[model samples]
Target: MSAQLPEITFDEYLNEQLINSLNLQTNVIQNLAQYSRHISFQLVDIKNDVEILANRVIALHQQQQSQFLPPLQMFVQPSIPPSNSLCFFPPAMQVFPPLHKPFFSTTPDLPNKPVPFSFSTIEP
Candidate 1:
């Protein structure tokens, strides 16, 4: 004996399809909300990492500045000659002043200039 199925009206079929579509839409919305929340968390982590790196860079810059010496000032004597002197002295006596050895070396070793080279053939 074969079982007979009941016939559903067109309105009932359309209603079922609409309910399924609504359910699918609801699922998609939920998934999008979850993805948005995950992205926000990652952004927060990245922001924190950037802040840490910036602080380290600032510290390094300050350290480098401290290591370097301040600007040096040259000592200049007055241009006026002594009352006992017979001749008038120049306005400036020394143009470049010498540096102390304790703080810095006066002479630093520098690389020598490169010499020109040429190829020549020799007889055996």
Candidate 2:
């Protein structure tokens, strides 16, 4: 059997907490969404801080890239890679050989014949 639940006492602070608790949550979603009154304010502060940090990082990245890297040359062509570059292959090379003309069974093709065995071979 279910136990009887205790009644909640009315309080000025509790009423204000309940009211603000509902505001801290969003109702657009069907499922319950809730956050502490403190967390709500902290999240706003964090969002502002993140925006400021993102702006500073972007500005610093731009400044650093401009200062440390060479300027773009419109007529420059990238140096061609040396012709003697060596390449490596994985071990699956055991099962496969590079470009050998694929040959199937060595046996030549034969034309089809009718059924070789008959059921009338044995007597009843």
Candidate 3:
């Protein structure tokens, strides 16, 4: 003899489905939250490392500038003009044209004759 199964009502079925859906959504939200927290921690670490690197770069730049550059007083001091100096300025700059011919001019010219071409109708 075959055993008969009890009929499930539509309302009970719907409630069960809703619960499953809510459970799935809750798990997804929790996973996303955990992932976001992980990313945020990484970002925080990267920020701190970047800040330290930037500080080091600034210190190195300052040290190099101090080693290479002249004293600040020399730039600040005003120089006296010589009595024999002429108010003459240098001549204006001149622009020279390109030495070689353009690509289009270098290429051989096309023939004067019209190109022969025929269009055939495609049959279905």
Q: Pick the candidate with the highest TM-score.
A: 3
lDDT of each: 0.62, 0.50, 0.58
Stretches of candidate 1 off by over 4 Å are 71-124
| Candidate 3 local lDDT, 1-124, one digit each (tens) | 9999998999999999999999999999999999999999998888777666755654554454456445233222334555677863333222334343333454343233322221222255
lDDT of 1 by residue, 29-65 (tens): 9999999999999988887776667556545544544
TM-score to native of every candidate shown? 0.54, 0.31, 0.56
**Model 2 whole-model lDDT (C-alpha atoms):** 0.50
Please write out the lDDT profile of model 2 over residues 69-119, one tens digit for every residue: 563333433444556756533334324332322133442322232222222
Distance (Å) between predicted and true CA of 28, model 2?
A: 23
Which of the numbered candidates is closest to the native, going by highest lDDT? 1
Query: lDDT rank, highest first?
Result: 1, 3, 2
Give the candidate order by descending TM-score.
3, 1, 2
